[model samples]
Target chain A: MNEQEHIDKLMLELRRGTITIGVLSQLSSPQYGYSLVTLLDEKGIHVEPGTLYPLLRRLEKQGLLDSSWDTNEARPRKYYVLSETGKSVYEQLCVEWQSIVSSLNDLILNKGDDVNGDG
Target chain B: MEMVNRYVYAVTQRLPQSQREDIAIELRGLIEDMLEERVGDGGNNTDKMVEEVLMELGSPRTMAHKYRGSKSYLIGPELYESFILVLKIVLISVGITLVGAFAIKTVINPVEILDHFIEFIVSTVTAIPQALGWVTLGFALGEYYGGFKAGDLKLDKNWMPSMLPPIPHPKKTIKRSEPIIAIVFYVILMGMFGFSSNYFGIFRFSDGEFVGVIPFLNEAKFPEYMPFLLLLLALFIVKECLKLISGKWTMKLVVCTTVVNLVALMVVYFMITSQSFWNPHFMEGLMNAGIVEQGTEGYEIMETIWKNVTGATVIIFIVALLWDIVDGMIKVRKK
Candidate 1:
């Protein structure tokens, strides 16, 4: 593939990997599927409705999120929040993410220095 | 509103009955929220806004597939690699066998070579779809019974990197192609033995017309032992299939292989010793063809030669079977 397509594909995978953590971060307070989509979009994460809705269902099925329906509204909406287990898992994941970012930054910086040294 | 309902219907129809109602209600809420955001409080352009939102959301089938979390594939990823390996082995062996059969046919009847070539091509083309259909069916059944749940194809709660099977030593690991090729070979051999015993005979040609045919085994008696032969063939096929799925030598496989070989050897020994196994007219056909003279030294020599050949065949078969059993046991021991 051309450069743009290759980079786009890689970015898609990168974004997909982080989407779980991003969703978990948002679910601290109960949020309906559409509200969560809009919240993430405002943060420039830009998740699709189809993707976000399914992910919410899957997270709930895994007991990482607890969902309840609010029938008191104009239309019933399912609102999801983090479960107790989900909170602990999210905390662990944040620590893992920080370490990964630090290591990756070091590796990239060293590679850049090596390139300049060779030149 | 109608368009919204239709879109919701499209997505919900693909989901399970229990999930459809809940997902539909949630989808409707999401759609209305999207429309409200797009069209500010005015309801005048709602239909157009609904269409636009649905378009941005992508096709309902794609959304349904996402929500259902599994695409309906006839042969799923779990068995797909093994299926392709088995298909390749079957197709390649079948092609080679068909070519070999064509060559034999041409050698036996040079003048009718064109007819044989056409028949071979037709047979090969038909055999492909037949083999593929059966392989696909077998794998589909395997996938169904193998406890593969929808949306659970990848590693989930019960999976861990540490749970990965230990890498087998090169000698202990079975090549993916080995069992596949063996299964194909046994299938074809069984078909030939069960259906076309007459085709194994000696053919004589004279004056551009087929002359005497000395049949190897009595065709009439074949059906009497067909049930037993079929049972053995089924057992052999099962053994090969198990090997292909396991992809490594285990104690179970070793025991199975030993049992199948032993039973096959016993069957072969019994058949060879039975009077009905050989055609009664074979000697007479040889005499009629003038290959041997009646009540002469030539006839006695021919009889003695036939006896020795059958004896040698039995010995060779027994030895080969023993070798296979021993080899399997050794491999298992190494593992």
Candidate 2:
């Protein structure tokens, strides 16, 4: 593939991995799909409604999210919040993410030093 | 708006019947929310806003696919590799067999060489779509009833590295296509036997028509043995299908294979030894046609040769069946 396409694919995978953690972190409070999209976007993590809605449904299906429809407004909204199981899973995921980030940071920082040392 | 309704309809139409109402309601709510948000931001031109919102949401088909959580693939990615492998094996083997059979026919009767090539081409072309249709149908059925849901594509919370299957030794691991190909081969053979027994007989082109010269097997006797033959074929097909689905050699499969083969061998033995199995008038017809001179040493030699060939064929089939049973036992033991 071309360089631009290669980078685009890599970025897509990177975004996909982070999007789940981002969604779970925010779903501690109840948020409808559109509101969740807006919240993530405001925080500089732009997720499309298309992606967010399905993910919410999937999370709910997996018992990671609890969802209920509120018909009190002019338009009904299905709001999702983190389940009891989800809270534990999200905390574990955060710990794992932190370890990965630290490991990667160390590896990346050492790259130039290793090359320079060899020279 | 009409545009909103149209888009919702488009999305819901693609979803399963059970899911349609709930998804449609959710989609309508989402769209309305999007439009409301846009209008609140002082967006003029309601039509333009609707179009923009829809565009941002992406194609209705893709949105529907996301909501449904899976694309409606007749044979999905989980089964795709096996399907393609099975298709290749079946098509290639069928093509080879057809071509090889025709090539032999051409060699025996050089005058009909052109006809043989034409026959080969026609059969191969027709067989491809037939094979593809059957294989696709098999996989589709497997997908439908086998609980191959969209959720299967995801890594669930319970997933662990330990869940991965141990890498099998090459000899122990059964290729998924092996049983599928065998099933297709047997199905085609069954179809031929059921519908075109005349094709198995000797033919001569006369008066611009291919006429049966000397029938090898008595057509009338076929009805008597057909039910037994069909039962054996069904047993074989079921065994192959079990193999395909399991994708491995197991004790149960080995036992089933052995039983089926044994039953099939008995049926074959009975048919071959039966009084009405061969056409009684075949030799008389050949002699009358002057193909074989009557009361000659050559006739006696031809009869002896034919008897020996039939005996050898029966022996070969028995040996092959025995070999398969032994091989299955060995594989099961290895496992």
Candidate 3:
């Protein structure tokens, strides 16, 4: 009900859709579940292991990601990478995302301009 | 290590069988990786560190919910509002029917009225849970089979502007009171005619003392008309339910109501014409009470009027039904 809690909810909604794009962008190379978490964390996306692992499995089910077990490691790990279909899909998504970002920036900037009495 | 395995088991058990094994293995590996990052690869990872890693991941159920993103429900959000609306209408009508039935029974034999009141309360208590259970079961099936969203069946089709229903004017909206009052009215009629038609008669009194009653309906014929009357009641209640659910004058609803009313009209015609429907002794009772002479014009006129009374009411009812059907069709067709 307070302003901060309200803002946090809106921010969560904004991140929910774009998180898939972020995950897809990083799966060009095979990355294990833990490795992907650390990678995204280092890049400041901050996804949980619980959240990322399920997302990886769902994307694989949709044929947008491929997975294999790397049992050769000390601890058996499942590594996920982009599939043939995934690559094209991610490319198209990136194009759409760029257009969305530009349009949203324009809408926000124009509102600011109108408030400031400048075009 | 023990805590980590328990956590992994908790999350994987909720997933599908095939998924359980894979998710269990992946969750364990992820836990180990987190533990290693906290304590150096070979630096003794204490219980505290393992607990911290598990805590960061959240409860097992929250983790499972995230992994299984699909939502589940007995009555989902889409149909929940309509389900509750129907439940309220059904419960109130059933309660009224019980109350009316008990009241009529008390009047018939003139037994202890308090006992009838108690029985009415008890029946309403039992009827409510049965109503709730049936409505919940119905809505659950509606949700489970995914029939509620027919649009999902044609997911590949492009939506056109013309496919949208036109917004109804305020007057075109089916007021909640309309169908609710209609349902209550029909149930009261059913309770009266179905159970205690013979009891509907004239009561004589002298010196403010209790006196016997003269019945109007042929008691023997009441059972014969039960099925036909029940059919009419069912059709009318169901039509009102549909109207209540739709909440507006859509073409589909208008057509459906029209069809149901026409069927009820047929049943109403047969009801008034049956020879045994009205009591043949009604005129004799009136005359024996010294209200009229045996062959007076008043007696003959009263007899004639009583014979055609049910028919007149039936005619009026048919006309009302016809008017409702026509009015619905016209409202729906309006721009």
Compare the candidates by TM-score and give the number of the best one. 1
Ranking by TM-score: 1, 2, 3
Worst 10 residues of 1 chain B by lDDT: B147-156
Candidate 3 CAPRI category: medium
Candidate with more favorable, higher TM-score: 1 or 3? 1
Residues B1-335 of candidate 2 have per-residue lDDT tens digits of 89989998998898779878877788888888888888888866489888988998899889988877755667777778878867776677566667666865675567788888898788778877887888889889988776654556565556899998776556655676777677667765765577566566667665555555577878889778777777787788777767776666677878888888888888899888877887877777777766689789888887886667568878998999899788877877774
Off by over 4 Å in 1: A101-119, B12-18, B41-43, B70-81, B106-118, B147-187, B230-257, B288-291, B306-310, B325-335
Query: Interface-residue RMSD per candidate?
Result: 0.7, 1.2, 0.8
Q: Using alpha carbons, what is the TM-score of model 1? A: 0.78
lDDT of 3 by residue, B1-335 (tens): 78988999888888768788888888888888998998775667999889899999999998988888776457877778889887887777777788778866676545567888888888778877998999899999988887865664464266677778677798679998999899878877776777567567887655554366677777777788888888788788899888887889888988898888888877777776767877878888888887678788998888888878887878898889889988898877766
Can you list the residue pairs that collide in candidate 1?
Answer: none
Give me the displacement of residue B224 in model 1, in angstroms: 3.3
Q: State the lDDT at A60 in candidate 1.
A: 92
All models: lDDT?
A: 0.83, 0.80, 0.83
lDDT of 2 by residue, A22-105 (tens): 999999889988888889999999988888888888889899999898999887888899999999999999999999999999
User: Candidate 2 - CAPRI tier?
Assistant: medium
Question: Candidate 2: where is the Cα deviation over 4 Å?
Answer: A114-119, B70-72, B76-78, B97-126, B147-196, B199-212, B223-258, B292-335
Ranking by DockQ: 3, 1, 2
